[model samples]
Target: MKHVLVTGGAGFIGSHLADELLAQGYRVRVLDTLAAQVHGDGTRRPAYLHPNVELQVGDVCDKEAVVRALQGIDAVFHFAAAVGVGQSMYEIAHYTRTNNLGTAVLLEALIASPVAKLVVASSMSLYGEGLYRDGSGGVHGNCERTLAQLERDEWELRGADGGLLTPLPTPETKAPALASIYALGKYDQERMALITGRAYRMPTVALRFFNAYGPRQALSNPYTGLLAIFASRLLNDSPPRIFEDGLQQRDFVSVYDVVRCCRLALESPAADGEVFNVGSGQPLTVRDIALRLAQVMGKPHIEPEITQKYRVGDIRHCYADITKARKRLGFEPRVKLDDGMAELAAWLKDQAAVDRVAQASAELSARGLTV
Candidate 1:
């Protein structure tokens, strides 16, 4: 059996990725610090509690821990990091150390280890504002292409007079520039991984994920992604909070789909040293997303409350050009935004069971299920 290591395997995306790896007949190993901030109440534990999973509780920044966990591993899926734009903006130093330097540590360890394949998780925040400028970066033409592709989606262009303007979808080539410390850090992480992989002649794939969401997300975590936050609030009859005008758009992809692409990146030789946009290629406004959640849950019309407080460096519109991912990795997002919303709603409704599983995993972890 193939032995694979996933860093940050207890967090939302990382945990789900572990599940996918196991299902595909890979013997999975998870390395995580089980940080209190990530686990909240110290209840959520190592993701690989099952017999097939080998769990290691250690910091990725530690060479000893990383090297030990990487032993006998054939591939590495590095999903460990301080994620989110607003949170990273506030915790700049922490983000840099964990995301940037931590990746460097992993790469260094991998260079000495036998692992041959690596898949790095990245974000769309790297593309500075897709502005159309004269040989220089400007906001005009760059944004025009994005607005064009998302034309059929929720965010339609309105003339100054509130008249309808042409709309378009954001493509992979024109990634919105990083507006926050977290985004900049993640962008740097990808660059470092690519450069280092080239030096080592290691097969590496970087996936620029766009708003991935699903079940294992921590509802109590304030920095949780928007989709999970909405699902959690709606399940409890709490009004979902909106930061902006609720008009800003984002391309929300399902966690299942995101994991699918990660596995593809590992298995496909063509994905090595390449970056692919993993998303639904469909843009949905924040308002539409909230409403969709409500509809999915079959709840009374409870709209999210609009808050004037907007995080600095937050973009007004963002989506993806999934064409490259589809053509190269043979990846096609199976779940639509609506379908994903419904699935998330179902999971949110059953938090009691989810909590049990989390507790069980934590218990097992405390008993040496993890090192």
Candidate 2:
């Protein structure tokens, strides 16, 4: 059986991908530091990870660790990084060093120990406000909400004479509008892996994942994954806070679908030297999704308070146009939205998810990240 090395395999998406790989008869090895933010206070292996995965606790930025993990690996999935768009704004040096420099170190290690396939994890945050259309049937996509407009409580994008702009599906061809340090780092990682991998003759694939959520999500990391944060609050019988009138849209793909798409990229020849947006084709408003999840958890009364408050650098709307992934990787989201919500609710019932949202909000407030 072929062996695959998954960086950050102990985390949510990577762990699920590892389980998928193992089931497909591939020997899976997990190389992760198991960061305290994601996996809790201790440096212990996550119990959610499949026991069969050969766990190697290490960091991707460490050359020796990366080189050691590459040994006997036919393919590599580079998914290790400090995730969170808001936190990255203030932790500029930390995010740059971890995401950008970490990828650089991995590329260098791969030169010494080449792998057949390399799939790097990217994010949809790079798209910023997504595509938009004007009243004149003109498409003006990928425009960010200005701070001045945000201060005025003008959440939606506007055109000439304050014409309302409607959201559009963002395809892979959309020009990236990096709004935060985290998004910039993910873009850098995507480009670095592709450039270095192609130059070294290694088949590379970049998967730009939207908001991925399911089991094993880190409730502690408030910088990313709105679903996890929402779920954490609901579990604690707290109101799921909705930002910006709760009308901002996002594409929430299941981790199962994400893993399947990742597997396709790892095995398919067509996915080489290409980038694909991996997200549920369906778009839902933040308010709607939070309510849906609350209903799933039998906490319909624990409604999401529409705070009308938004964090800086947040987009008005961003959803994926998954035509490229479907055509190239045969990737399609199979998990229905209701079913995914039900699954998440069921899994979270018995788990103790510490509600860190309050602390996270306070931290952001102190940094002026939240208005």
Query: Which of the numbered candidates is closest to the native, going by highest lDDT?
Result: 2
Instruction: Flag regions of model 1 displaced more than 4 Å.
Output: 43-51, 128-167, 352-371
- Residue-level lDDT tens digits of model 1 in 1-371: 28899998877888888888899899888998877655755655544345566778889999999999988889999988987665665577899999998999999998888468888998877664322323232234344213332333333333334444432445556644666788888888888888888988988888988888888886655556777667667766767777546887778889999999999989989998998888888878888888878888887578887754344456666678788988999999998776777778787776621113234224433543221
Q: Give the Cα-based TM-score of candidate 1 against the true structure.
A: 0.83
Please, what is the whole-model Cα lDDT of each candidate in the order they appear?
0.74, 0.90
lDDT of 2 by residue, 1-371 (tens): 28999999999999999999989999999999988888888889888889899999998889899888988989999999999987898888988988999999999989888989999999998888788889998988657777888878888888875889988899989998988899899999999999998899999999999999899899766665999989888888999887789989999999999999999998999999999999998789999999998999999998898877778768889999999999988888999988998999999898777887888778888999877
Question: Ten consecutive residues with minimal summed lDDT in candidate 2?
Answer: 140-149
Q: Backbone clashes per model, in order? A: 17, 1
Candidate 1 achieves a global lDDT of: 0.74
